[model samples]
Target: MSKSNDAISQLTEKLPILLIEDDITIRRFVEINLKRSGFQVMAADSGETGLSLMENRRPALVVLDVMLPGIDGYQVCSQIRDRFPEVAVLMLTALSQDLDKVMGFEFGADDYLVKPFNPLELVARIRAILRRFNKDSGSLLCSGSFRCDLRAQQLFMDEREIELTPQEFRLIKVFLEHRGQALSRDDLLNLAWGEDFVGDPKTVDVHVRRLREKIGNAPSTGRIETVWGSGYRWREGS
Candidate 1:
């Protein structure tokens, strides 16, 4: 793995992110910001490369650009949604056309961003999406032989208390709250970091690893399954 990949793997163990933009300058700029915010970022300069990386890296979230040489952002987003339904996509476009936005959403974009946007605001939006959509509001969650106390922001395994960092606690809470559902890195990012968050998805992965360690779960035990071409999920009866 390259240094970037190593960094991403480490962070995905906490946070994992993918950025697909044809513009080199913008890609580098966003990658820098995301890395600084404690995320692992994977970058591809074209829609084709982006899609290929998505298949191999399985990033939690994807930042896709609308215009590209081969596959446009809309087409790419649609492909991801169809093949990797769990992955969360955020479409970036220069056009402000309402129809364009609608098209992005229709193609399964979780969020949309116009050019010349504030990086900070983008980060915030990412966090919001993760919080709202990553979590399953319909079901209660249990993990590590313990149940989560959402009201108290605590985890209990085997009747013993396990302390969790605020981020870890929140991540686990989301998983438990949405038990049995797969949450993409973007989903976690939107929930934990916010929609406008410029951070990388690797940050979410790292946090997840820590969460698993704290909960006494193995990474490959199916407690938290990695959905190839998508993100992660907290499986029931793992």
Candidate 2:
């Protein structure tokens, strides 16, 4: 490989992967496999240590197990999103229900992996999540006057940064990904909140109300229209 290519490969392989799984056997197995694959692995048996490692080591991706002793994966995931917005999260859990999965996504996990998962598949999902974020570094998502810098994970309207909560950012991300298309509340929930959210559709309404307020009266973004009987749509043009 060329020098530049070799450097890139090393960086990719060395990209930190923190595994916060309580099961000793499972943690060891995963850590070994990840090490074999050339990833820098940090295995934490509890959520507290994992969070500590996150603060200290600053891993690029976190492989979090949902059912921790005290804090649990959901809370850990929430803290991760709140503290390290750029770090990608992949949840590993024995809870395979759709609601469980939705809850995982609601906590801001980039991907979910059920227990008894193939080691290869787990690694592949991690790679996919990392690539998804990596590929967007310099790209932009725009609708009217609102523009999102994918690399920077920041939104701007008329050249000013639009402060957004993690949930709002994820919601806007869904809208930008499916720009010009109307998304039902369920669709929005699934796309933005993940499939495990088994709550009232009204929840979507509540968030949308808040989101519209945050986005404000900008012309391009003004096209964020309610479809009356349906859900919502972000119209792109005149």
Candidate 3:
């Protein structure tokens, strides 16, 4: 066998997901659909079981419903963010309120979608999140106690995982790849969101703020410094 082929085999790993929804119908539907789409899924009808699965299973991402019996989604999301910072969370809610969105974001949800959601849309959202995260730098990256697992798309501080949203994960990947250089909001838009994205560049600012909050001093720069007139840069050294 070719050396590269052997190396690839050695590194390949499965990306599993967890779904926490109280409704039996939705849970089975999502679980089956996720499996059909080639993702290994772990399903739970309660937040307690979901948390239990998370501890034992260590899923890479979670599809969580906001409304659930016992320990609601918001609190569960909070707990997940606090305990497993590396696991990505996608919040499912029935409410279309801006307040609901704000609450989810504040509680560390990576993505939020309304109920009666399209199965395909949920699949697509999951794919997008994983795609952003799946970019392996081809080597383990580190600065201080923080380590980046390129293969798994997970960040760890002193071995504890640090959760990051898909956008935030992409942002860090971009920054690390361009370390020592100042990246303007536009540059970030192109790199992180891709040139195809027609959204405003100001959105980059929001994700950056969120990323900084989660990664904290783990960044080589100790902080993502504001570039004043230009944008932001993940400078090396504190």
Candidate 4:
């Protein structure tokens, strides 16, 4: 362990993080940066070591590199998601293609970052994810058996918790905030993915379908209403 790791271990008493990357230079750079940003960082040089640490320490979040020596980041992320669903995984890699990002999400990564990344920006992203996860876990909003707590970024039905991706959470929030009002696909694109994001409206439709599958279990009187020609709306009472 390096001196920075020692400092991080002491300073980040409650903010445990697992960093899995094969590059020594990059790992050192990230470890130092994370320590400066107030995160207790545990590093692994390979996916196998990362998994062993994960089984033992169970960090609050994982910063994983997709191109690892053994097993690969996707396999590691899938294993983590299957075994420890609450732990958040953020994929940090050199692969920046849209397909790579989609693959990371499919493998259960919470966020994806292309490498040669800015150190300060990485810190900021980590903070935002942690803040969202912490907030969602502690509070919930209820309307009948359906519940959504913006803090936890979670939804529930009949007291049963539902898992939602970050994109799904943003979409649901937009609908809930403007309940009963029709929102166009463009409106959702701006709200969920930001005005600068260049993606087709069909992305919103795909996310909505996933959200409905998770939260729309009851038959009829659905929570989300689809308009024939326009967009969609959240029903006030359904």
Candidate 5:
């Protein structure tokens, strides 16, 4: 590998992984496996505790369990997405149904694994997500009055910071990268959510709508135009 790739790989391994599992057995088991895989682990037994730790020591990725006390994984995942858009979320759900997986994604989970999964597979998934997210760290994308700081995972409109969820941040980044190009829902899902995402194609529409709302319809912020047959376009020179 090249020097840059080696640096990113080292960086990916250095960021801590937060594990939020209410079950003691599972938490300890997963924590051990994560440490064995060369990752630093921070284990929380409750969603509230996990959220609290997030504030104190933000991890690069979170391994969240579906069933938890006082918030549940979905709610915690939503909070993480809203509060720490840079942190990737990997949900562990006992439910293997498609609906359950899709629900996790809607709540901003980067990926989901059914319960009784192999420890190696879990570690692999976590590694994959970290590597993908770490690809462009500290880069900035600017257009007109908008400035996107990938380093801080922040967006600024006319120098005013605008809040965005994790999904919205990814979507906006893709749109900014492909400004003026009509990108289909599938195109967006693949680009923003990755090819492994197992959710409805229309999920792209929901996220795009939210992103548009955050960026606003003001001409200064540019516009997300909906084509008749195509999906949407981040219209440039608007």
Candidate 6:
């Protein structure tokens, strides 16, 4: 097996991948492929069932479909972000429009894939997303008044913990790592969302804005300064 597949297999052994798709055929196809890929799989037919599974199973990642019967994928993704900010969500949909992809990201999906996608590609994407979360597991990333415990996956400002969605946490982690440097949208996207991410650069702006709101304008939050015509920078020092 490839190194990527090896990583996915190891990660999924402990935490199953939750599959939420209303279409029985697609659901089973994905479930079989995932199991073949050496992943632990839990299948759900509806968003409600998926969320319920999330409560108990606490899967490492959710493979969610957008066209569920009740409480569409966006709502499910939003709820996942609100309740389980640590879990990664990958939205599967037939809608191939850019707007739909952006909507998924806005609703807190870690990635989006349209229907008719290759099961192999789906596995690769899952590996990529989970890999991003698992990277940098040993050490703390500290800058200004922010301190991030990499192993614990927690961020604190002024020694107080701050709640963050997975995306937000990744963004801040990138910012703290590259303080005082003007990181362009592409740079931030590649660092935080991974180069495999398919979405708008505006998504970076939205996340940065939200992170700013959560961290506030306090000098300790390490002022996120916008470089005109460029991107953003984390001010050096507290």
* Highest lDDT model number: 6
User: Which residue pairs does candidate 2 place in steric collision?
Assistant: 102-196
| Per-residue accuracy of model 2 over 98-146 as CA lDDT, tens digit each | 7787777666676778889899877766665554444444688887778
Give the least accurate 10-residue stretch of model 1, judged by summed lDDT. 131-140
For model 2 the local lDDT of residue 153 reads 74
User: Cα deviation of 46 in candidate 1 (Å)?
Assistant: 0.9
- Tens-place lDDT per residue, model 4, 1-238, is 6985455444444578999999999999999999886788999999899989988888888999999987999999888876777787888979767777777766767676888989987876676566545433355555546677776667767678777655567677778777778999999877766664444566666667767777773533348878869999877654
Select the stronger candidate by TM-score from 3 and 6: 6
Off by over 4 Å in 1: 1-13, 136-238
lDDT of each: 0.70, 0.77, 0.77, 0.76, 0.83, 0.86
Clashing pairs in 4: 135-151, 135-152, 136-151, 136-152
TM-score rank order: 6, 5, 2, 4, 3, 1
lDDT for each residue of candidate 6 in 146-185, tens digit (9 for 90 to 100): 7989888899988999988877888988988888899999
C-alpha RMSD of each candidate structure in angstroms: 13.5, 5.8, 5.5, 6.5, 2.9, 2.2
Deviation from native of the Cα of residue 153 in model 5, angstroms: 3.6
Native-structure RMSD, model 6 = 2.2
Reference-based lDDT, residue 129, model 6: 82
Worst 10 residues of 2 by lDDT: 128-137
TM-scores for candidates 1 onward, in order: 0.54, 0.72, 0.70, 0.71, 0.82, 0.90
Q: Write the per-residue lDDT of candidate 3 for residues 58-162, one digit (tens) a residue.
A: 988999999999999999998998788777888999998777877776777767778888898887777666655555657776655556767777777778887
Q: What is the number of backbone collisions in each predicted candidate, taken in the order shown?
A: 49, 1, 3, 4, 0, 0
What would the per-residue lDDT of candidate 5 be over residues 80-126, giving only the tens digit for each residue?
98788778899999997777877887787777889899998898778
Worst 10 residues of 6 by lDDT: 5-14
User: After best superposition, candidate 3 residue 115: deviation in angstroms?
Assistant: 2.3
Roughly what TM-score does model 6 have, to 2 decimal places?
0.90
